[model samples]
Target: MLDHDTAPTGDKTIETAEDLSSIAFGFMASKALFAGLHVDLFSALADGPKTAEDLAKAIGVPLNRIVMLTTALASVGLLTIGDDKKIENSPAAQNFLSKQSKYDFGDYLRYQIDQQMYPFLLQLNAVMKDDLSEDAIASYKHWMTDEEQASVYSESQHAGSLGPGRTLARKVDLAKATSLLDVGGGTGAMTISLCKEYPELHATIIDFPNVAEIGWRFISEAGLVDRVRYIPGNAVEVQWPGNQDAILMSYLMSGVPGDDVEGLLRKAYEALAPGGRLMVHDFMVEEDRRGPALAALWQLQHMAFTPEARSLSVGWLTEAGRKIGFAIDDVDALIPAMTKLVVFSKPA
Candidate 1:
């Protein structure tokens, strides 16, 4: 009943009901954030504070929506409102969302927006109902052939591996390695990163032909053609080329179901020569597999090949490797939660 001008400044009417309603529409906030990132609003703010009018000119967001959008971001703490009403990046935003910072996480936002993740957001029920009937996988084939789609997914993984991968790669002596085969090696991030670090390393990227073409292009861009080769084919049906020292599977397992995974792992065991290694870098959940919520959630999303509903665990790999005649070694937890690097080796 109170008029805005006459009312006291406060969250006077907000209640749990209102909060619940907000939660329902929380997706609006996500879309707005995505749009802002797409327009480079955060990167723009990275330079310094800017008034609404100034932001409009710099980032090209609709002039009218600027204040509303900026205010929303500020309310969420991604930005700060200065004394003069100029807005700037919040500390969190600067460290993670700003493009200029190497620790920047702006790409995190972009990947969701640019990828088919948005439609899925609107159609999650359909997605949950075994409903890729409407061409759902067109944009989100967990094993996508499109270079850009795969790159988006892989870069998201890179961001996650950021703190951990760097430290581990530096600490681990992959220099003794001779060869590696990266299954479904989209754009070759793991292989490329490893090879770039170890001069003695050579790798073969195995994936669908269309996907391999993209990985090849990316490898050429990195100028590592001499060190890595792309072998395009399906991992399930094809016999993985053998006589390799190591095989790297990064974030590829969870996408596949258990029976399929067992088949692939069996193939991997056969593919390795005596004393060779199989590197399974993925979400290494706890033994009971109750915690690590994301990994648990991912198991549902990755309904491929009808994998056992039980999450993939370190214990699972260690035991499974022994069964396949490969001794598990170097199975350490990598920095990013839900990702572990387990080395399975054939007996000499």
Candidate 2:
């Protein structure tokens, strides 16, 4: 046992008991955020700073209760309290959490985490032990069967995906590709982004019927109706449109069952014209898979629901693409450290 002063210099061990305590109590902060989103606390503070009592009134909560929540939020840096005792949204909270903001993703967080993931994770231990109930382990396929649940998921995912879609547009050069196939393209978020980025580009999005309904609304709202089309079917079972210049499968690889991944890639290969590009973007870890904690955790989250889902890594994708007779063009991070985009091309 080494004292704090004599701990190994290069090691990243806990410096103090408080550090370990912070890790143990990490869920408290997450719960605080969930509660804040639940009561529309960030949105309430969006207009301006307000007294604790005024905030309670704004959100229709009791004064003391609002104060306790606000204090916790402020402590977690999601909100701030001035010397005058007025609370306001922090910069991040104002921009992303507030409903009025253009970049708002509060609903995404609310639905994805508070409503779905949090409850799903409660059975994680059982899931790992293969002891979870069959009915309770609702995979993405089962979830999509429920119209209401599918609508909720598609709506929230559309909102969350738009920013990342825009990011993808910036990172990849698709200017010359006149036609695109967006496989499993939920709500047309990525298609809309690509269409908006390239005026000459036309895209066909393939997804479930319920998801296509939502996708049409988004595509119409984006004013790309003429340039984009939605094909409603199971991406795996449906006959895909062929001879495409580019194919993008964002978030598709990790969402599907492990057994289906290779088939999808084969389909993409067969669907594309010779020399066509296939962009595979999803939560992918490093080859060694030692870190990039968020990416690994997301893969685990998928496993909790989809027992057959596999952890994807750049190494695996590259090798798989090579085996499919694709020439690797690029492999890079799409969503910073959380996701990767690998571009492969069929020989002309």
Model number with the top lDDT: 2
Q: Candidate 2: misplaced stretches above 4 Å?
A: 1-17
TM-score of structure candidate 2: 0.92
Ten-residue stretch with the least lDDT total in model 2: 1-10
Per-residue lDDT of model 1, residues 184-231, tens digit only: 676676777788788899999887665676568668877898999988
TM-score of each: 0.80, 0.92
**C-alpha lDDT values of all predictions:** 0.69, 0.86
Maximum-TM-score candidate? 2
- Model 1 lDDT at residue 76: 73
How far residue 8's Cα lies from its native spot in candidate 2, in Å, is 18
